[model samples]
Target: MNKKVILSTVLFLSACGGSDSGDGISLNKVKSNDKAKCSNSRLDSCYYDINQLALNIMFRKNDTGVLNVTASVSGPKQDIYFTGSDVLEIHADGEVFLPTNNGADSLRYENIPDNAQIYEFFWYRNSQLVEYNSIDGITEPSVILSTSQHDGSNTITTDWLNNPDYTYQIHTPSLWCTNLNYESEMFSPSTGILDNQRPPYQATLQALYGKNIESLKVNYRSCDISVTLIAKNNQVNYRNKQKRLFIHHDNFSEHPLTLFESN
Candidate 1:
């Protein structure tokens, strides 16, 4: 198998809810139902039923005259989660724009007209948007929603060992094996395989408390791999930190191993 494909598969399996077993719910359908409920209501409701499944929903009125709506479902080994805080402004003509804060440094806008309001949303493994409804009038969210397969178990085991202050673990896998060729060069590269350059090491990161992982980069040199994780708090200040680990292998070894943060 190709190295990138292999790494992608390995990371996909290691993260939660990649199993073939029938234990997860279809979050796309759930989001569709949730959006339908939002449109059907004069005011937002907390919970809604979709295909006989109950989902927790929330909405906030932002400063932009748009309603920020979020919907999520929680359970053990199985959960349906969806979130989009972009402004849902009802224009004087009743149109909407799901204006997204592009990056911490930039902003992008998606206009949602009134004709097409129904949307099907989905968030699959690696925070990838697997599927969604491209309705004529509904603008999609800027940030991708988090989703998991639900197996009827509502209990979720979170990582509280590293930081007890938070109850969940952020799932960010370092992509050193895929991106950096420490064995080939002593200097760190700036790009990755997906960027049309020598693959830079990469990692998938998950944030806690509904936080989105942002601004990630890797530093490599002299058989050393360093991962930097950053997240925005309260839509303003940034929480930044770095994870440093050493990579070494014997000349005869077939697979290289990395040791960092006790992992």
Candidate 2:
């Protein structure tokens, strides 16, 4: 037989699955294309820009003292999870985004056990892990509220945690109040002050009470701020070195307004 003919036969056989390299694309390569796994930090940084996130979480206590958590987030690239578990049961709620697409997500979990002081949550896409972290559990005297402004008026209202949670209000005018772009606990009941005021506004308000609970006023300021609560408290504390109105309690009757003033 001619050498060319032998070469042609070998080529034909190889095309017909006779080659040693195996026929068709290797199945292993295709199978290896499965989704990539990620650590909590890795996944979080991948989908969410930690620098531009606004996360608000509120926990309300039931009659039994077990707290229920509701979280709202803005500017997240994917879905997230608020998870907590004890030996007996798990408190897990998925699909927390309020609108469920591109917008913010609001998730609620009922009867969160009090055993864990901090709760962890996660962000995921296509069954792949993204971001996760632990949050402080809501104890007694917890203050949670949402702050927004319109036409030079800032409205501070109670989030889910406001059923006799605390007595206060943001009475200051000409202020820019926000969550300070934080993902952790805002008001610490032990200190009795609005400890965490999301940045761009550094004024912290103190809830003052004499008999019927008088006013929520700014006790700390980083700059020249001339503002007052609407109903009461005409004086402002600046460099007064006051402890910033510290209060801690197991129960209360009033939900005071929290104001964020900026100048």
Candidate 3:
């Protein structure tokens, strides 16, 4: 195997709905030659570059009552739980670039701005940005909306440790799921407004709310960014030398599911 320094300058980004050259990242970067497992096995390509990455962006409130925003990234390279790296960063909305600290096997950031309209994740080495492979997706909020568990047991049996498993909503402009309200219970969330604008906020508005959302002047502390654009954030490597720079991008957030299902 004659490996040479190629200084590959191509960048790759794919998310939610998978992509081919026609709709998403360029197909030239996706030469499926390596048979090794990718960080995201769901993707169909191997022998790729931008080795193992799993990023989970969550918007929740910490104990101090401030919104806690975190992007947890791991390098599941080869079979190990981490990848070799030095730095990580985020591109918030337009040209704003935010740097984050990296641990041995993971990348993380917090204190994200409430007004940040959209965000893109990236990995860096030696101060320059590098592409990532197989983003393991965000943890989209799940609510037990409308269930039969309350047929007389889970809801009425009061001597409980957690909140009653009942049908309620935590509403964003588009998402009616969890509440920003916190009852004086142990790690339980009340049903009310969404605390932050998450990636799914806008889609919730269009799917269930009216078509005149922009005209309605609805305000949220968080911004609902499209998952499709979550992968829309890609960057080029600046280094002039490299041993192996294969190419691939994986954003697995587009798994199909019913927003609401009735029992």
Among the numbered candidates, top lDDT falls to: 3
* Candidate 2 Cα errors over 4 Å, as ranges: 1-53, 62-64, 76-105, 142-263
Model 3: number of clashes? 8
Instruction: Indicate the TM-score of model 2.
Output: 0.28
Q: Candidate 1 — which residues are off by over 4 angstroms?
A: 1-95, 98-226, 235-263
Ranking by lDDT: 3, 2, 1
TM-score of 1: 0.17
> How do the residues 1-263 of candidate 1 rate in per-residue lDDT, one tens digit apiece?
10111112212122343322121322222222234223433122212232223333232323243534434333221432323211112121233333243111122334322233332222231232222212112221122121222112212221111222212112222233222443433333333322111112223222211211121124333122332211111211111111111111101101122321111
Report the error of model 1 at residue 68, Å: 15
Tens-digit lDDT track for model 2 on 177-210? 2323422222321122332222122233332211
**C-alpha lDDT score of every prediction, in listed order:** 0.24, 0.30, 0.31
The candidate with the higher lDDT, 1 or 2, is 2
- lDDT, residue 170, candidate 3: 25
Question: Which residue pairs in candidate 3 have backbone atoms (N, alpha carbon, C) closer than 3 angstroms, thus clashing?
Answer: 16-254, 49-246, 49-247, 170-177, 170-178, 174-204, 174-205, 197-222
Instruction: Estimate, for each residue in 1-263, the C-alpha lDDT of model 3 and write its tens digit.
Output: 21122324434554444334332542223322234333434231222244444444444433243434444443434332222333344443343333343332222345444345444444444333343332222222232223222221111110111122221122322222222332121211223343322322223233444322332223322122111111211232222222222222212122122232222
